[model samples]
Target: MSIQNSIETKVKEGFLALYNTEIPTVEFQATRKEFEGDITVVVFPLLRYKKGNPVQIGEDLGKYIVENVTEITNYNVVKGFLNLVIDDSFYTNFFNAIYSDATYGFVSPKADEKAVMVEYSSPNTNKPLHLGHVRNNLLGYSVAEIIKAAGKKVYKTQIINDRGIHICKSMLAWEKFAPNGSDGQKETPENTGLKGDKLVGNYYVKFDQEYKKEIAQLIAEGKTEDEAKKEAPLFVEAQQMLLKWEAGDAEVVALWKEMNSWVYKGFEVTYKSMGVDFDTLYYESNTYLLGKDVVAQGLEKGVFYKKEDGSVWCDLTEDGLDEKIVLRSDGTAVYMTQDIGTAIQRVKDYADVGGMVYTVGNEQDYHFQVLFLILKKLGFDWAKQLHHLSYGMVDLPSGKMKSREGTVVDADDLMDEMTATAKEISEELGKLDGYSDKEKNELYETIGLGALKYFILKVDPKKRILFDPKSSVDFQGNTGPFIQYTYARIQSIIRKADFDYSQPLTIELHEKEKELLKQLELYPETVQQAAANYSPAIIANYTYDLVKEFNSFYQNVHILGEQDLNKKVFRVQLSKKVAETIKSAFLLLGIQVPERM
Candidate 1:
């Protein structure tokens, strides 16, 4: 058991013996720095059960603990707080126990545990991913890794928004504006040497431009703004195209498949570059009409009602939400309908999936709320397990991004920019003196990506981010490269040790060494807390704290240079463990560390 748990058990025993009163729990916090103790037990909460001076009560408990708890060597009472100083041997034993564990803080999933499906990077095929998508992917991937480390099985998945008016807009624009006819002569990713998604996305922008021109011309011909917008020739043609695509017209389907294939290839390159992946992919083209059958079942069960216009909706006003439409008036499935069907289809495919996490933007918070509620109302037992990982917008310094306007910070471009920044900064610092050009470039990529991922992941997910690329790549402060550099320093120490430093030893602990060990002890608990909160920020900050502690120890204490062989070996061991913990924490955040940076 943890020291805190043991203390709680003993504290309850003390309460029963002293005042003949039963206390169910105890509250403890890290002792303040000014206080001469390692842990503090708050005596304020016990006043309700045992009516007396809190200071006296704390003194009595401290005496009881020092007498009964062997690990606690000494104690002091400050007001209502009882502070206990633990023996150094306890920390030494704890360090020894975890020293050889390569995966010390991770727990493996048990056989009976149900799997969690984490859906992230659910991007549209019309455009490449951008900065906002970067945050989503990082957050989702990190959360999934953390959950796995906390002993739960996890499956990464995404739903591709491959079919919609937005996609058709791109296709229509490409067909009308490409240099040649819509055949082999058309502008392809190969001939143009442009990414497939970018090429397709350019056309999406072109469609908007042309559509706007048509709308203006119609308005000039004495039509109202709304009338012109609806009556524009381009708009009508796009609607017709959608209808034909839904009917599975061979020619339209062929074109859609070809263009979407280009987009899929483009997305593969970007996802690879960003270091994110999914175990399964659900396409809207296949799942768009899915929830129609479910809607019919809901109608029979009186969970939904059909209006005179033939639109289907679930009445949720009684449950404090407005009625939500599941199907259109023409019997076509809406987005909500498709979402319900897709969620159910996932369970059918993966029987052991007990819950799903939707890593979507906060704009759709209400949508998820309704979706989960409707599922529960429809009698899905697993609906209660659903969660919406709602996150705020990520903006660049200039401002927000608009995909159709092509003003967004493209994911590929952002990553390339980070790499270039790292290269510049590393060269300026002259840290890569002996490295070959190839090795230097690879290290730059690692540092660059690490900075980008760490800067974004270290913030609370719900908080908006104003990302500055240059600021994120800094070599100092609470940044990814900073922590990574510390790890590299420890690696250098390991390499420079000429003699064996692996033997177990007992030595007097320096204050810095003790502080570092205290920080290391929190790693497992940090991982568990990060998983429970579904927040990568917790792990990211914990790693920063550990790095800070190790740096302090490194600066103030001697490792290999120490004359005492036992002290030198123990310090080396402590440094190695700290480096291992940093690597493990960074792994959960999807950040990489360089051995020499």
Candidate 2:
């Protein structure tokens, strides 16, 4: 049993024996820094069972704990808090047990545990992934890793929004504006020497620009702006194309396949650059009509109602939400319909998956709420396990981004800029020595991407982020590069310790060493907590705290310079373990730690 568990049991036993009454449970917390203890037990709650002064009760319990608990060397009572100072041997033994464990804090999935499916980066094929998608991808990927570390089978997946009017807009723009060559073929990613997604995205913007001009022209001819928008020639053609493609028009379907193929290739490049991958894939083209039959069954079961106009709706008014449309009046599937069908299809594909997490932005908060509710109303037992990982938008100092205007920070471009910034900063610091150009470039990438992922993951998902690329790559404070640099520093130390340091020794611990051990001990619980909350921010902040504690220990203790062999070996072992834990925690956050920086 852990020392804390033993202390709790003894405290309960001591209370029952002394007060002649039993307390149901015990409350424990990390002892305050101002107090001289490792753990604090609140004595105020004990008064409910037996009325007495909190300070006297604390003193009595402190005395009983020290007398009964061998690992607890001393105790102090400050009003309602009973602070217990544990013996150094407990920490020494704990360190010894976990010293050589490379995967110390990670747990393995049990045989019978149900799997979790995490959906992220469900980007539309019309554009390349942007800064907003970066946050979504990072959060989703990190959460999946944390859940896996916390002992659950995890599947990372995404559903591509590969159909609809938005995609048609790009295709129509390409057909209308694409330049022909001597061979009589229009521009392609190959001919244009551009990424497929970027090439397609340029046309999406082109469609918007031309549509706006047409709207202006119609308004000049005395039509209302609303009417002009609907009457715009480019938009009308795009809509017609969507209909034709839906009806299996060969030409339009061929164009969609070719364009989407290009976009898929480009998407794969960006996803690889960002270091994220999916276990399974779904496309809107395939899943768009999925929920139609289910909607029919729901109508029969009275879970939904059809309007006189032939539209299908779910009446959620009694549940405090307005009626939501599952199918359009023209019998076309809505996004909700596709989502419903796709969710059911996923369960069919993976029977072991008991739950799913949709990593979508907060703009779709109402949409997901309605979707989950309707699914539950449709009587899927697994619907209870569904979660929407809604997160706030990521904005830059320059202001908000618009994809149609071509102003959004492209994900590939943003990553390149981060790498450049890292290169610039590292050169200014002039730390590179005896390193080839290739090694330096790789290190810069590690620092840059690590900085980007860490800065975003460290923030709570519910809060909006104002990301500044420059600040995120800094080598000080609670940043990713700072932690990476510390890891590298430990590596330098490990390399210097040429002597054998593997032997376990029982010695009186330094104050800094004990504090570091306490931080190290929190890693396993922190991973579980991060998984429970579906937030990488928990693991990120915990890692920062651990690094800070290790730094304090390094500054105050002598390792390689120590004359005593036992002390030197123990400190080196402690430093190595701390580095391993940092790497493990950063792995959960999808950040890489460099061996040298």
Candidate 3:
């Protein structure tokens, strides 16, 4: 049993024996730094069970606990808090127990446990992934890793928005404007020598620009803005193209497939560059018509109602939300309709999936709320297990991004920029004296990517972030490079330890060493907490704290300079364990630690 668990048990037993009162629960906190203790017992809560001065009750309980618990040597009562000082042997034994555990904080999934499906990076095929998608992918990927570490089977998935009017707009623009190749064929990724996604994305922007120009021309000729927008030739043609693609018009469908294939190829490169992956994929083209039949069934069962214009909707006014449209008046499916079908299809595909997490931005908070309610109304048992990992938008220091204007920070470009920044900073610091150019380049990428992922993941998901790349790469304070540097320092220590240090030795601990061990002990619980809350920030902050504690120990104590061989061996062992723990924690955050930085 953990020392905290033992203390709780003994505290309850001590309370019952002394006051003849049975306290149902015990509340504990980290002992205050000013206090000489490792753990603190809040004695104020027990006042309700047995009325008395809190200080007196604390003193009595502390005395009882120290006498009964072997690990706890002494205690002090200040106000209602009982600070218990634990023996050094407790920490030493704890270190010995976990020293060899390579996967110390991770738990394996049980075969019978239900799997969780996490959906992220649901990007439109019209544009390359941007800064916003970067945040979404990082958050989703890290959360999935943390959940898997906490002992759950997790499936990473995404639903690509590969259809609809937006897609057709790009298609129409490309057809009308793309320059022909020398072979007399229209521009393609191969002929143009541009990334398929970027090439297609340029067309999406072109469509918007032309559509706006048409709208302006019609307005100049005396038409209302809304009428001009609806009547614009580019938009009208895009809408017709959508209908053609839906109806399986051979030429349009072929064009759609070819263009979408290009976008998919481009997306593969970006996802690889960003270091995120999916276990399964869903395309909107395949799933857009999914929930229509379910809507019909829901209508018959009174779960939904049809309007006078033949539109289907789920009236959620009674459930504290506005009425939500499921199908359009012309019997076409809306986004909500497609979502309902796609969700059911996923469960059919993965029978063991008991729950799903949708990693969407906070803008769709209400949409998810309505979707979840409608699913519950339709009576799916797994509906209750649905979660929306709603997060705030990511804004750049310059301003917000606009994809249609082609002003967004592209994911690939952002990653490349980060790598460049790392290279510049590393060179300026002059830290790579003996490294070859190839090794230096690889290390720069690792530091660059690590800095990017860490800076984004360290923030609370619901809070907006204004990311600055230079600040994230600084090798000081809460940044990733600082932690990475510490890990590299430990590796240097391990390399220099010529003598064997694998043997675990029982020694009287330094204050810094005991604190480091305490920090290490929190890793398992930290993983569980991060998974439960669906927040990577918890794990990130915990890792930063652990690094800070290790730094203090390194500064105040001598590892190799110690006269006592036992002290040197124990310190080396402690330092290696701390590094191992740092790497493990960082892996959950989707950040890599370089052995040398």
Candidate 4:
């Protein structure tokens, strides 16, 4: 249990025993930045019982609670709140207990005793991943990590949208413009392989322009409008191609096989660069047909009915939702169809599985809400286990990122900019020493990727964030690089010392050190709360606070080469311990720290 919770529990027990009414929910307010108290508790909730003068009431209750609770060494009433100071022994015990045990502050013995599945980064293959996808990837990755650390068994997966009309647009453009341009395997003399997604994407844009022009030109020829459209060759060809591909036409399949492999390779490279991972990858080409059998069974079970237009419909108006399309009129499955199938398949495949969580965007909230409700109607009793971890869209300083507007921030480009910025700053400061080209590249990636992940994870999951290329990604003031710098400083401290652990140590616990240790004690509680609520931002915020405190201590206290050698040894050990704690915290938040930054 966390110290805050322990304190809350103690306060609640005392209040409940004294007041006799059902104990009010106890809340331990976080220590204010400028405050000297360990924690502040608002006594306003009990004001009515103490005859309404809030300040006096707070005073009386503060006295009674402090007198009764031995943990409260000293406490006072300020305004209508009780400012309680805990004993240093609590700080000593808490810090020792906290920093000693691992889990980096995550709580154990998870409630509900069930399983969870998290699906994130469901990227379409028609384009390379961009900044929006980066947000999705980091949120999904960190949230899954958070949940797992909280003691739940989490399954992380992704759905690859490889087969669709949009993808066909890219293929069409490629066929018309780049007939023999792509070997897909060819790295040019410059050693640049045409990136699969980009190579494919440019053609998609080309197809749109050329197809529109052709349609307009044919319309100007005074042919009947419907006739002009009907004579469009690309659509006819693309449709025929899709049919052929679906029918196992050997040549078309081979082309698709080769093209998709290249795209996946490009995607893999990007995923590696960004440090995202997946336990499983579900392909639309393979899983698109997945729900047909289940949807059929659902129809038989009266979960769905045939529409007048011969499409399959699930009537949800009884539950205040409109009737939804299940299967297309042409017997083809749409997005919802594939999802229904995937849900059923997952259950059957992992029969002992506890639940599934989709880390999709907020736009898909209606889809999953409807999906889960439909599963319930289909008599899947375990369907209630489904969850949707909906996240908001990421906007830039200009506006919302739009691909057509050319405002989309490509993931590769963003990382490159960040890496270059880190390198530029490092070089200007003359910080890196004797680094080879490879080492410099790797260092840039570590810091650069850390910057990106930290930027995305710092914001609350529900609120949309506006990214300022300058201020938002800066290294100082609650950023990942700041934490990395603290880690490196600690490493430097450790490297300069060969201290004796066998000697008996007495902790003087100076003001800054005590406050820092107190904050360190809060780590486990922070992790538990963050993991429990699926918020990595909490961990991010805590990590920044820890480093900030460490920096304060670093500036004031001398750890190495202290006049008192024994004190130097103790501070060195403390520095080592802080480094260890920060590294673990960074890992939990899905950021990595370079040994030197």
Model 4's alpha-carbon lDDT is: 0.75
Residue range 18-42, candidate 4, lDDT tens digits:
5654455665675575665778877
Per-model TM-score, in order, reads 0.97, 0.97, 0.97, 0.89
Better structure of 1 and 4 per lDDT: 1
Shift in Å, residue 527, candidate 2: 0.2
In candidate 1, what residue range of length 10 has the lowest lDDT sum? 177-186
| Reference-based lDDT, each prediction | 0.92, 0.93, 0.93, 0.75
User: What is the clash count for each candidate, in the order shown?
Assistant: 0, 0, 0, 3
Error of 2 at 24 (Å): 5.8
What is the per-residue lDDT of model 3 for residues 204-264, given as tens digits with 9 covering 90 to 100?
Answer: 9999999999999999999999999999999989999988988899999999999999999
State the weakest 10-residue window (summed lDDT) of model 2. 180-189
Q: Supply candidate 4's per-residue lDDT for 450.
A: 80
Q: lDDT score, residue 409, model 1?
A: 88
Kindly list the per-residue Cα lDDT of model 2 for residues 135-159, writing each as its tens digit: 9999999999999999999999999
